[model samples]
Structures are given as structure tokens and as C-alpha cells.
Target: MTAYDPIELKRIRWRSRRGLLELDLVLERFFAQRFDSLSPAEIDAYKRILDLPDTDFLDVVNGKADLDDPEEAAIIEILRAV
Candidate 1:
């Protein structure tokens, strides 16, 4: 199994914090519960999603927006489930 860098994980966790309280909670929970186990591809997808605008990100999390990338969509599904 691949070991993730602790500093990178911390940076990702910091990026996960969103302006919306609901988003913040969901992301924080996901990071706490799942971040360490994620594959590099999944981690990349999560980071890309974090770069999205707050409105678009929320829409994707809330199931209002559909991601064109399957990898990203899968990651969003996981986030929503959290």
C-alpha cells in the first residue's frame, strides 16, 4: 500500500474547509474518516474538486450538478455519502 505524506494530507484537509458550514462538515468528516486510505488518483480528484467555486462545489455535493469526469463524480458521491 502507498503511504501518504502527512503534510500533504494536512494541506488537503485545510483546503477542504469551505465557506458553507454544511460543506465544511461533510468534507471534514470525509478527511477524518477516509483521506488516508484514498488512492493517489482519488486524492487528486478530491483536490481538483476543492478548487471548484463554492457554488459549483456545493451544487455537486448536493446532487444538483453532475461532474463530467467519472473520477470526479465518484469522489463527489463519496463526499455526499459522508
Candidate 2:
């Protein structure tokens, strides 16, 4: 498991808060349930994903869109699985 500083984790949690309620719920649940166990690469992927446009992010979470980037896709898969 990759250990994150509390500040970084706080920032991540903040970013996970999306404009859409469904996205927020899904991401918050994933953050709470999986963030602590993420590998460094996965954590990075999660951060990158947080930068995605809200619509794209929602589509990814809902399995309505596909990310061409493998790392992003992997992170989305993990989020959806959780």
C-alpha cells in the first residue's frame, strides 16, 4: 500500500467531490473504501482522473465512456468495481 500524507489525502478527497451527486457518491465511496490500499501508480491515475471533465468522469464511472489511456481506464474500472 502507498501511504499518503494527510494533506495530500485531503486534497484528493476534495477533488473527489464532483458536481454531480451520483459522481460524488461513487467517488467518495471509492475514496473511502479503496484509496488507502492503492498502489502509487493507481494513486497517480486517480489524481489524473480527478482532472477529467465532470461529464467524462460520470460517463467513465457509469460505463458509458471508455478512456483510451490504459492507466485512466484501469482506475475507472477500480472505481466502478468498488
Candidate 3:
């Protein structure tokens, strides 16, 4: 077995189907949990999260985002849970 650094881990994490879809789905579920309905804005927010840099992606999960913004908070929690 080969050892992996953070870069390799991030590359694998970002490309995995589970990592991609699951993170987005988690955010969707979170939105539903909090709002009882998914808003177009929330959907867009999730899409934007998908577009963020891989390092930023990890950071968001690691509690770097400002939780006051629902979109940012949702993305962060979704990533953290995954």
C-alpha cells in the first residue's frame, strides 16, 4: 500500500463519486431539514460550493466558513459530515 499526502487525498476525495454527489446531497438534505423546502438560492449556493477550490473545500468542512451565512454554513456542514 502506498502512503498518500493531503494533495493526493484531496485529489481522490474530489474525484470520487461518493465525495462529489454525497456532499451535494448532504447539503440538499440539510436545506430541507432547516427550511422544509429547497430554495433556488440554496441550489445555486450548493453549486457554487462544488465550484470552490479543493483546498477551500476541505477548509469549509474544517469549520472555516462564517456560519451566519446559511449557504456557507450548509456547505461547511455538508462537507464536514461527508
Q: Which candidate leads the pack in lDDT?
A: 1
Each prediction's TM-score versus the true structure: 0.89, 0.88, 0.41
lDDT of 2 by residue, 1-82 (tens): 5666668878888888879999988887886787788887788888998899999889888999888889889988988898
Question: For model 2, where is the 10-residue window of minimal lDDT?
Answer: 1-10
Q: Pairs clashing in candidate 3?
A: none
Count of steric clashes across candidates, in order? 0, 0, 0
Candidates ranked by lDDT, best first? 1, 2, 3
lDDT of 3 by residue, 23-70 (tens): 456545554464223354654455566566655565566676544567
Candidate 1: tens digits of C-alpha lDDT, residues 6-63: 6887798888888898888888788678767789889888888889998899999999
User: After superposition, which runs of candidate 2 have C-alpha atoms over 4 Å from their true positions?
Assistant: none
Runs of candidate 1 exceeding 4 Å displacement = none
